[model samples]
Target: MARENKRKAAEKAEEGDEFTGREDKRPRKEKVQPSQIKNKEKRSAVYAKLKHEKQVEKRKKIKARDAAFKQAIELGEEPAQKMVPRTIENTREADETVIRPNDEEFLAGNDADEFSTVLKQQTVPKVLITTCRYNSSRGPAFIKELLSAIPNAHYYKRGTYELKKIVEYANNMEFTSVIVVHTNRREPDALLIIGLPDGPTAHFRLSNLVLRKDIKNHGNPTSHKPELVLNNFTTRLGNRIGRMIQSLFPQDPNFRGRRVVTFHNQRDFIFFRHHRYIFEVKEKKGDPKDKKSKALKEKTPKKVIARLQECGPRFTLKLVSLQHGTFDSKGGEFEWVHKADMDTSRRRFFI
Candidate 1:
């Protein structure tokens, strides 16, 4: 300790200044002024500017692609394929059989009448809703929500039966459609819609599926079915969601004893509701005088049944439009809908 003191005294004498015990301190960080914070107007303006710039850039790229494709075609070279922001290109060659003399005469005839006749003969759809065998909690809740929207649907919990066997059962029992929910990260995030009796299957990604009980609703039973209506559902996104919902039901809506199902999207949330029509005969005001009077009294007025039950744990989907006709994370023109902004309430707004 004495040697250190002597060294310090010597160093102080050489520098001609007194030595302090404390080490040098770093400078304090400058505080941001009030002007540094961006206000609401400024933020909106900047966002609008950026959006405009992006749109301009996108148009430029599309024009360049069109020009290149045209040039290649003119030069007798095969044009490069592109699949994005558009439907898939038809790559199949024309079949010679379709153009044969026998087929040509038949093709020139009316086919719409046949399609209309078949449509008229279509029957009510019986649907089965299920989830992945491995999924329990999330899948069950999702299935329950869907069932509440479609009260007449049949449900089978996951794992009770094999997929192939279940499909066979549906075919035998004449179930019109089958809906399967898939879970990821302990949350339901996808759906599979299959038509009964060996038909096409469509896969859909269900995103941002938050339940009311998880967000605001408590342990109380939250079932109230309202007369659901889709308002201002006219955009491309709205049309796609509408089609997906429609595919869940049977082709025929005029089936006897079948309830009406409505699915409409405003903003991005798909709303569901069911309705049934009631037809009852009017009561006779006076005693029947003759056979004609009795027959007249039997006639009843037809009225739609009142739909007072309002039920839901409604959900919003994060639409991701994919390119290459695939739902994978990677591929095609993909985008997520931003519906988190509080300024616009999706539920209250129609479009």
Candidate 2:
């Protein structure tokens, strides 16, 4: 060490001699130092980069593992996704974001829960009103009128064009029964499916109709409300009341209709209905047509009248009052259904 210091001092003196324009016989000392802070910083940066790279590799491996498990379950393997420890090599970590051990696995667990819940939830029957054709020369005015009367009714534009929308909407809500409306071929041309949800909701018949549009109007279609058009059936000549019971009301293995025992509608609430037995109709005090209703004043006792002589007791007609109220406040027998649950994973359903 002494020899080295002597040499370093001798080199500095020789530099001073050169400045004075004299010859010097000594070597100049090296100016660079062995312990500069800049060198230390460069070493630190390299170490940090290596650590961060290792951490990134670990996270990517974890992510891939989680995603595979999720896909396996979705493909019917039944096994589900799980998480495991993931390492990070970096010393400094960000505060806002946490690198999950297995993020995709966490999401998979949530998806499984949703699927389980949806499968168990009961599904209600829905009444569907679809026109085989729309945007015809005549407008859909009649359809509009009935929709006004029935709230939450499903309406669809024809074809597979709007089928996806139907499935999506049905997934989000429930239905009671489906009613399909079509044009009548005869003078009274209206097809209606009623009294559904009592059995399999698919059976409906157009055996009874008012008229044939072709026979009466000669293909001249008229724009009118369906209700008004149905009323025009009264002018028909033949009593062709072939409801096709076999086609419309099939034997159901699971359907037992619900009976309504009581109804409560008063001044406090507007959910009121006419209290009546069979063959009677008590018009509400506030309806516009109540003044013109002769049945309300007639007060006919409950009676059973057989429309056809060749019918059994089951086929006999019992004259009954038409119950009223917007929220199904009829005090009699009715059909009830549970809410419909559907799988929303790109599946198709009838609307």
Candidate 3:
């Protein structure tokens, strides 16, 4: 009986060991990173291999999609919808301030805004462009380009006068707007646009400046007022800023000049581009087998194509702040101010 008990005890111990072993399995293997590798050559080789594999996978997916599309065509069935890749712009967090098409309040506000007179053609826009008190080397060059770009814009020498005094003088002179180009370290770094009479001031951070001479094969802009194209200004603040920019130019645009000044806003950054477009006719040979082409002599077909030439001085602007009143730095009430903490998420945007 003692021997039987020992045998049963041995079986029970074995079962417990088996149960414990199942519960305490080996930990998962961690993924090895290229940065963790000590050898430079091996790290680089592994990284390249990984990149090649990813490219191959991408190509395979494209090929599969093409094959599926062709099969659908052959079978006379509806093709699968094209997949749109995910991007930050498409996946951005929803914003409540985006203006809708039939927003009556927004429309009314626009009609009664500070820029209404200029936009409505009641008053012509006379802009006064000036530099900071201590101007940089490139500031004057940028100002010269602005003078050409904006109609009836004059450059005033910023000597020892304060900005408040300048704003007062511009108001007295009937200037519709004041543009202060701030420079630092020999570069034009910021732009301050203040609407006159009644107030609303906008400050922008300027970057990626390319002058007229720097652009290759640039066309010279004419003295006629260029057409304005404002795109993607959908939010409340964006519309306000767009109106302010629109107020800098005259209401009527001379389409005959074929010059276009575009302020394209994407991801809250404004891109400024000037271009001269021309339409040209080009002859092309038609298909010989088609009945229409055969009747038209197959070689005399002409197509009109529109081409654009860059009229330079390109730059980008990001809104830093928008103040309710004019250039009173200490006492101004800001409608919106960009802060470091505001950039917590890549998918969040404000305009």
Candidate 4:
């Protein structure tokens, strides 16, 4: 420690803090702690074990291959041709037959000793997500990142919802997860369903709230009135939303799509994660003339940013809480009402 003191002492003295002990003392060697040495040994042991298992696994695979080859030879099967040219004997009119293996036979082929049954295997769910913005862009980009973290994930353009040809896409693949992204304008509404992660279901409001809730994303349900942009959002989204959500399968909380919320497109809807609804963003579109309406509508863009930003943190808390509640599905869209079915009293708000 004398050398360490000497090294530091000069600098310390220059800096006006006195260094204790002899300036000429020899530097002590750093003590190698036993715990560090043990840790190195443990790491080496783990690596050695992993290497051994890999080698053993490689040997087992080779043995199985050799057994198959020998059995094939014993059964007088044709020898596999090496580097054969496909064009040599191939003809255009040859009928192709595809053979599907029997499930029982396939299961029988797996080594009984090995854990080869498909049941124990965990599958990452395939996800299809859409956002309010039609760009094969931000929403698609987020899905890519999500799929990177998962496996067997799929993504598509939100605009494809508009196409008549999209039925094939909808019918061909089964999505284990479907997500929609929407921006939060205020405390998000009652009807907003945030997906859960484990499977194809979700929670609304607080997962634990144990109450039925219906929401109007762009409209304030409490006020029983629509905000200016929220009303426009409702109308604009109403026509397209059913097509957008039709292909989506819902998932429970912990779903990946709802991971982030963006203010970038609040003027439109953001249906994030796996969901059945869309967000209706409310913004002050123009100068308000009336005192009460102007006071409510005239918040700065900065406040809007805060409201949207709070979406993620609050949603995460709600999801993590797993607030237990049951939702009874209400028929039809919130904005869609047929005059034939509506009571005259209820039609007052319809106009």
Candidate 5:
């Protein structure tokens, strides 16, 4: 019995060894990369082949989706929902500062904010636009376009006057906001937006400025107040900034003018675009069976397609700092300031 047990144990050990040996002898597959090829021609060929394979796979997926959709239609069933591609904006890190639609506290706070009076239409928004002490020719041109864009906006030349003095003057003149365009090396590089009377000032780094004349086939702006569109201003700070900007324009827009001023924020950068839109009637030919049907069709409004023409002076703004009360560099309280450490993560965003 002892000898039989030993023999069985030995057999089991041999089987284990055999399994290990089998695993060891198995050929492992390694991923073949196009970069591994030393020959440039071969590398190019491999890259092309890989691209072709990807295209073929994509086509196959599309075909399969089409086939499934057709089958669902035939069976009078719901088609599969298309998958939404993940993007940086969609996958951003969750922020507590992001404002919710039903936040009573935020809503209440906003009602009594500095720009609240203007936003509520209690008072008209009067904006005073100015440049740095040392100005450039292009600065005036940009200010001219801004004048056309914003209603009740007036430009004042900055003739060696201090910003504090200008802010005081704006407050006295009952201006709701003050825009100070700062230029560096003859190029407009920064913008200072100061909310009048009380406080809350925002400093933005400006870039990618394109004037009205630079735009091809740009439309002329009318005196009518253009509609204001503020997009993606979701955070608490963003909301304040949005309100400040909104205060620059009138509450009521003249839709007849078909003019629009859009401030679209993406990746914490605000893009300014002015456009004039016109609706063109789309004519459709159809034969009515009877006079009544013809009369009904005629009563129906014609399909009008909207077309947009850019009214330029397009630029981008990146928020640098937001101060609580006006422009005081040395002794001012900051609400939010952009720091180098704040940009450690690409998915993280302030506004």
Candidate 6:
């Protein structure tokens, strides 16, 4: 112990004059000075400036487009097309009713053809429309528009009532179908269509909606107010629901004819319309000898009409594809779907 103490004493005595190879066991971090904060602010300022410039450039582009369109109208040239890029799939393709199969396609079998023919002759339907209480403000407007389009549609406000109970109520009331709106973030985002008495339930995403107010057709006002046009996403969904309801119509109509039901959705609100489509002459304006005809006498506007015959029951139908991801699960009645399913070739219906 004495020899060890003497060696330590010798090492301590030589520490001031000689180097010992040893690193500090713990190092202290440098204190952050106020200057570092200023440097960070400087970097962020540069980013902010860049972001502002980009936004200005985008606004300028939009203004230019509007001006160009106005100029074209004055020159009597073709109006400029708005080339706004879409971040998501849109409904332009689904705008037409061509997605529904023709009589020749699915009506090949004698039994199926007979059933369709019966449906065409006698179609009466009763439908129930339910709106999410969270979206009451917009829901009623949509409901009113649909009521005008469809006949014998009942409206209800969905509060704390559960889906099972609602379905039961629909069944007891003798409703052919139930349409439910589901809201998210104060916006109507999804739709649920279920056939009464244990039929498949379809859920769809509703987007790219254009209501009647949004369209400025001052020269031509449609009777359909708060009109809704569903996008491609909803059209594919509607295709499925249409087929299900089509099956429900019996092969033979009663003395009153065939009865059909439909549940359509747009902008997250469910619409009901149950009428057969028919052709009629479109409306005209002014006289056939008007001076406006002198500009282009060679061009004649052919009128077109897409009307409904009010066959049995008047209602609307719109619903779509089964997907795994839109947050759907195997057991739930509403399944989440993917965007790709909108274009699937196997879809039973279109728009």
Across 103-176, the per-residue lDDT of candidate 4 in tens digits comes to 45534543331112211333223455444333432334334433432334455655546422232343346443
* Residue 266, model 2: Cα distance from true site in angstroms: 33
Global local distance difference test of model 1: 0.54
TM-score of 1: 0.40
Give the Cα error of residue 231 in candidate 2, in Å.
Answer: 18
lDDT of 6 by residue, 1-351 (tens): 999999998778667445665544557898544445467777677667778999999999989889999999999999967676863234333355344455455335434432243245454456688876577455566566545444456788787887677878887887766777666765556666566555556666664443334434312212221222223334434544445444333333332322223455443234543344445765455486767655564454657786543322222333444432121235544433436555554323344
Candidate 6 residues lying further than 4 Å off, grouped into runs, are 1-123, 218-240, 245-351
Distance (Å) between predicted and true CA of 343, model 3? 1.0
Q: Model-by-model lDDT, in order?
A: 0.54, 0.34, 0.92, 0.34, 0.92, 0.52
lDDT of 6 at 51: 80
- Ten contiguous residues minimizing lDDT sum, candidate 3: 290-299
What TM-score against the true fold does each predicted structure earn?
0.40, 0.21, 0.78, 0.21, 0.81, 0.40
Give the candidate number with the greatest TM-score.
5
Residues 280-350 of candidate 1: C-alpha lDDT, one tens digit per residue: 54443554555555566457344444333223444544333312222223332333233346335323332
Residue 114 C-alpha lDDT in model 6: 20
Indicate the TM-score of model 4.
0.21
**Deviating ranges (above 4 Å) for candidate 3:** 1-77, 285-299
Candidate 5 worst ten-residue window by lDDT:
283-292
- Model 5 spans > 4 angstroms off: 1-57, 73-78, 282-303
Give the CA lDDT, 0 to 100, for residue 263 in model 2. Answer: 16
Q: Tell me model 3's lDDT, rounded to 2 decimals.
A: 0.92
**Candidate 3 local lDDT, 31-110, one digit each (tens):** 89999999999999999999999999999999999999999999999999998999998998999999999999889988
Superposition error at 133 for model 2 (Å): 4.2
